[model samples]
Target: MADIAQTRAAPLRHSTAGALAGLSLAMLVSSLGTSIANVALPTLSAAFAASFPAVQWVVLAYLLAITALIVSVGRLGDVVGRRLLLIAGLTLFSAASFAAALAPSLAMLIAARAVQGLGAAVMMALTIALVGETVPKQRTGSAMGLLGTMSAIGTALGPSLGGVLIAALGWRSIFLINAALGAVALLAAWRFLPGDKGSGIDRAEAKGAARFDMLGTLLLAATLAAYALAMTMGRGHFGGLNMALLGGAIVGAALFVVAEAKVASPLVKLALLLRDPVLAPSLAMNALVSTVMMATLVVGPFFLSRALGLGDAATGAVMSIGPVVSAFCGIIAGRVVDRLGAAAMIMAGLVLMVAGCVALAVLPGVFGVVGYVAAIILLTPGYQLFQAANNTAVMADVDSSERGVVSGMLSLSRNLGLVTGTAVMGAVFAFAVGTKDVATAAPVAVAGGMVFTFAAATGLVALAVAIAVAGRRGRIA
Candidate 1:
């Protein structure tokens, strides 16, 4: 009997391992799609004989597609079947990658990328939702952390990998590599991931759920796209077009809320979603924390190059440290969350973020590179802790039917925060430097800008900590 039991359990263990590997690859491919093309932009420009702005569309198209369609696709998975949708998405991504690699014109390449982004939106949303099904309850945090680590690795590896591939086989090789990876990810997902048992959603679990909320999805997608465009246009300068788009986004948001309220089956359950103490605060804090984190990405390069007088290579090296640290810390943070519980770890992470922000604000100016590295070491680990715990808290108890939509919302919040940071934080830095062109600014001015931007970031993280504390108190009450 003991031998039989051990033999019986062996396949389950292998299945679990294979499932996790599939999910990790899904995350890695989606994130790699985001960062890999960025490094090849210049090469693409020269190849196509296009201006910088035109080539910029290659990246923007993918981002816009994901931002606009992610939530809809997630809700669609809930209505249809996550397993089926994920398989289709992976196939689409792989095919699109191949198309992108063979494109002879810039427009075709951009179109292919948009299609790829649609596929990625599905992968990103469903990957989180499927995690609940794949792992035991006790190991959820560890799984979430592992996913986080893969995301970090994809992000960190993209530029270096893209550079090597572009140099050896040309810019088209980047997309080819993604195509190969996507094919493997698709196979793993198909073979290892649990199949949908007659449409994935249980009728009892999804009471009152009707057909997919097409109207609400459309309204929300348009609003998000407008907002994304408003944030990104004019190269960080808010122009008349940006203002108009921003106004449109605000109006569209109001329409979406009203539409969702009236719809029998809404894309999002606004009341229940907002009312959940853990979920609401986690989403809010995720946005705030992501905004703060993006500040480092946007401001660090300029500060290192201008203020610290580092060359391009040295600046790149210093900037790579944050992602490298995040990649390693993700699993550790997850295990800690599992041990200490999500609630406690969330607060602990916030506290560390506050300290890290403060350190970034002060230490870099005084101690230079050493101080910057120290601040990053503190900040990156804190982010990993918060991410793992927050994701665990949100998804741990989510209803089976609602998981996909909720996961999409989580990704949406983080993306919005990143977009906001790029525009708002960049402006703040420029204003602090007292110049539009930061490259020409004096070292002292650049350093002052760095200090000012990080000072604001510190306050932002402190605010997040306060929010976390209040949420915990309310939960206890």
Candidate 2:
């Protein structure tokens, strides 16, 4: 494991609070980009006279674009300059948002969304990486926690906000809102962010002519696109096409590895990922925890509506609790991590997640919605703690030149986990219910599936705990 650096670049001379605000808004808008359009999909389908599957691409295009381009853009930031590139990203995002709002055709909207996602990928990657330059080392956890809070707020707010906008003004209002917010974020960034002292890359590294690996970047993007499509296509029903794409992902991954190994400056350093105890385990735990979190999103609603017999409004309200709790708890979690240290807080967070999962597995069946809410109360804070601590642990020690790429990797791992959870955890729940059509499954079966899915989530988090412990031990060794 690499030793955690006590410091990175010198702290910014500008107002730290303002810089944090800019970063927080950047995180918020990017996260909002992810969830805001989801609730508007049906509205879009009707408005565009498109099939549900075609409208679904409105969401998929954004996600696929981000997943494909995030790391490449991160690497681009390291080479070109994070601050300059981020400004460009913000401009692109704002323009793309307005474009989406005014798009005359469904095809154009999807294309605009794809471009918006490219901008989001840059924002999401550089925000965390830039933290080192914005804040003092001692407050890293707190800054991370604040960013997490903003992200949770965005995710929690998006669906409800989009619903309201669509009802009052129409679907296009959502994109218009994003355009407005993107403009504000861009202004904040331009006015408050620190100047790039060394342009992200070390002067020595730049002098060495560290070039971007375009082939490696393309191979990785293609591989990730294949995997994302495989996991997402067919609406959770893995078919022949999904299987073929999955195979393509595997082969592409192999080729990517080969290309990366031989590249003069790889997008990702294979040796660093393989040998860095902290980075490797951190990425794994992030994916695992994200998968568990997604289970709550994918499976919780089913359990609430079918098993508990909640109405649509009631289900949505109850389902919003986790993100709301996380939004509030994020700062507190960061404080705790700052006090307890990232490594220790990690174990503590995982323990709480395990407990939360176990409680969910049995409490809902025994105590109903109250039990579910209680379990979430326990789980959400744990997630905030883990997210803040895990991010801090990974970013605190990374080579300064590679911060952008590392941040991108962290985001990518979480996204991959969500994609996996949507497919794998959903399948697990459906299998447990013993039904192809979960919407009409018996209440008892839905409850049973809830138990099974949360139980699996427990095991996954427990494994993450083990990984955290091992990483700590490796650090000590």
> lDDT tens string, model 2, 105-174?
9999999999999999999999999999888988999999999999999999999999999999999999
Model 1: lDDT to the true structure: 0.91
Best by lDDT: 2
Pairs clashing within candidate 1: none
lDDT of each: 0.91, 0.92
lDDT of 1 by residue, 1-477 (tens): 999988864422327889989999999999999999999999999999999999999999989988898888888888778878998999999999999999999999999999999999999999999998888889998999999999999999999999999999999999999999999999999888886656445542366775778899889989999999999989878899999999999999999999999998889889997789888888899999999999999999999999999999999999999999999999999999999999889888888898998899899988999999999999999999999999999999998887888899888888888988999999999999999999899999999999899899988888888889999998899
lDDT of model 1 at position 399: 86
Let me know the TM-score candidate 2 reaches against the reference structure.
Answer: 0.96
